[model samples]
Target: MKFIDEYLSDIKDKGLYRELKFFNRPQSKYTSIGNKRMLLMASNNYLDLCNDDRLKDAAEKAIHTYGVGSGGSRLTTGSYELHDQLEKKIAIFKGTEAAILFNTGYMANIGTITAIADKEWIIFSDALNHASIIDGCRLSGAKIVVYKHCDMDDLQEKIKVYKGNKRFIVTDGVFSMDGDIAPLDKIVKLAKENNILTMVDDAHGTGVLGDNGTGCVEYFNLKGQVDIQLGTLSKALASEGGFVAGTKSLVTYLRHKARSFIYSTALSPAMIAVSLCSLDIVKNEKERRVKLLENSKWFQWELRKLGFNVLESNTVIIALVIGNAEKTIKLSEKLFEKGIFISAIRPPTVPEHTSRLRITLMSSHNREELKYVLDKLKEAGMELGII
Candidate 1:
């Protein structure tokens, strides 16, 4: 594979190459890497429930009831009572008529989009939608029209230009890298006026938004207005699985047509149980998310006070733009050496010359730990000439 070597060399030269960093401890505000206890600031466990004992107990109980792996695909012998219960629970949580589960959020997006739209359809997607949505639109063989990020006017203009009866708009409820939320209320209005369908992948919003942590749909107070609601159990829920909530007919259609759902093995009973328990925790422990958001606001303000270009975000995900890929990596490395772990997001994940440090905060992180992180970031930013 000469081409593979060439590609690797090209990325290395461009400072776009990526490698894995192994963690020796459970995912939390603090974790160990190679015997060094590092402060974790780049995890998606926003509510800090990943290491909760209750979730562990739930998983263990489910494991005792049903052995680990799901025997087969959902349509086969893999279907369990626990799976059915979770799906029903998800529907109730999201305020939808029904719901279906997938192996991951990526799978859910790719599967649902392809299942709903095809060659005859046109998809008006947000410019900053997650890559999974982009892939799903591409695989569907539909004409994809990308509007400017979170610009409703651009969407309206494109909607008028791309005329199709079978048209739907898909967007990420909360963009992962930029940490900005899409204008779902305006999108829903446009969809209604234009007679188009709407889908929102609330992967980052689930368990971290809305009064009851029901996600973006509830956050916007447009409960039953949106057509398809997609989410993941992995983020704040601290579990592993993806799901789509919509009308019963849509769930039925996806089960028959979505290849990712029809072919992949069902999620294990233990993971499903963990998801179930975590959802309950998210509902009961609203204070966790409340504190998480409060700390995020304080943290972002502090970063700006240090002269960093922090993006405007209401969610826990924060983006501190550094513009240069190599410099961003250097800043991350410097911070790591200072006992903090924040990811350097580079090209392809973000726009060129817009490399950034994607810092995420957990509810369990206190002011003392955050102040320490800010201090470290200030030192690194000054050394790298980022501030």
Candidate 2:
């Protein structure tokens, strides 16, 4: 009782304790979070297809065809026709020999990383990689070397210092917090030069990057250069699953050994069906991406002009640096009250003193809503003395 009370008290004192906000309806540009129906700008639905009628219909069709769940682990009785079709489609979309799906992106990253790497391998990871990657590295039993954030020279120096034949360089294709893209252009070149295999967690890159939405490798025009590319259907794909695209042998290896994949139940049939439709939507509808880019660029310019410290987010996930967790949380709550719902991101999600309001834009948002969010943000900034 004493220990629990003390920890709860400390969390309360820090103003960092979080709880769930029940979103009443479909996730859109203006939807309910908690009691307020605000201008929702904190979602990763970059193409705005989550609530699309086509995807909804696809989901319904899947439910009727395959029921609610996969019923067991994939190797057992779970691998249905839907999973096989989805896997084949994903491989074709990603230009890989094979693709494997996991229930969640976290599981995919952790399972794949931990399964492939062993004591013989050395992992050189970017400092700002997603938490899933960090945890995966820990479980991999590989000697880890942390390089400076996106610093190629530091990565090179580390690569030179290490003398392992099985050297693996892992990085997030898009740094989730700061929203800056990785130097995949540089990372790929260096990886090839050093003969080190490369793995990119393209969680934020798929369905949002590249012409075909093939992710960072395609975006950077480094398709075959990257050995492993991990993508998620949850973000821009607007579904709930993760995939690793690589050589047929690599994916086959993961299928047998990855504990998360081996033991956990497969993704629902509805999600897989919906994800297929999502891919089609991404390919056919270019307007969504155009609108998304316009919104992102406009917001970034306006936020900076308004004298807010909107960091180097060249993509969809922009951050307004509030510098303190308490202030960030307070701003988020106040914005919620005003019907402008954006989330506060804090450490260990971000580095200390870099607490921010993680403002994400969606393709479904119109110009008026974007303008309103900005104007309200201005008011909130002035009220909070951040301006």
Which candidate number has the best TM-score? 1
Question: For residues 1-387, what per-residue lDDT tens digits would candidate 2 score against the true structure?
Answer: 999989888877877677778898788777875566767888888777778899999999999988998899999988888899989888888889989999988999999999989888999999999999999999988998999999999999999999778988999998888888899989989988889899999888788778776778888998777898898999999999999988999999999999999999888899999999998888888777777867898899999999999987767889899998999998888888788888899887898899999888898888888888888888988999999
TM-score of 2: 0.98
Q: What is the model-wide C-alpha lDDT for candidate 1?
A: 0.95
Q: What is the C-alpha lDDT of each candidate?
A: 0.95, 0.88
Worst 10 residues of 1 by lDDT: 378-387
RMSD (CA, Å), candidate 1 to true, equals: 0.7
Q: Which candidate tops lDDT?
A: 1
Alpha-carbon shift of residue 106 in model 1 (angstroms): 0.5
* Model 1: per-residue Cα lDDT over 19-74, one tens digit each: 89999999999999999999999999998888899999999999999999999999
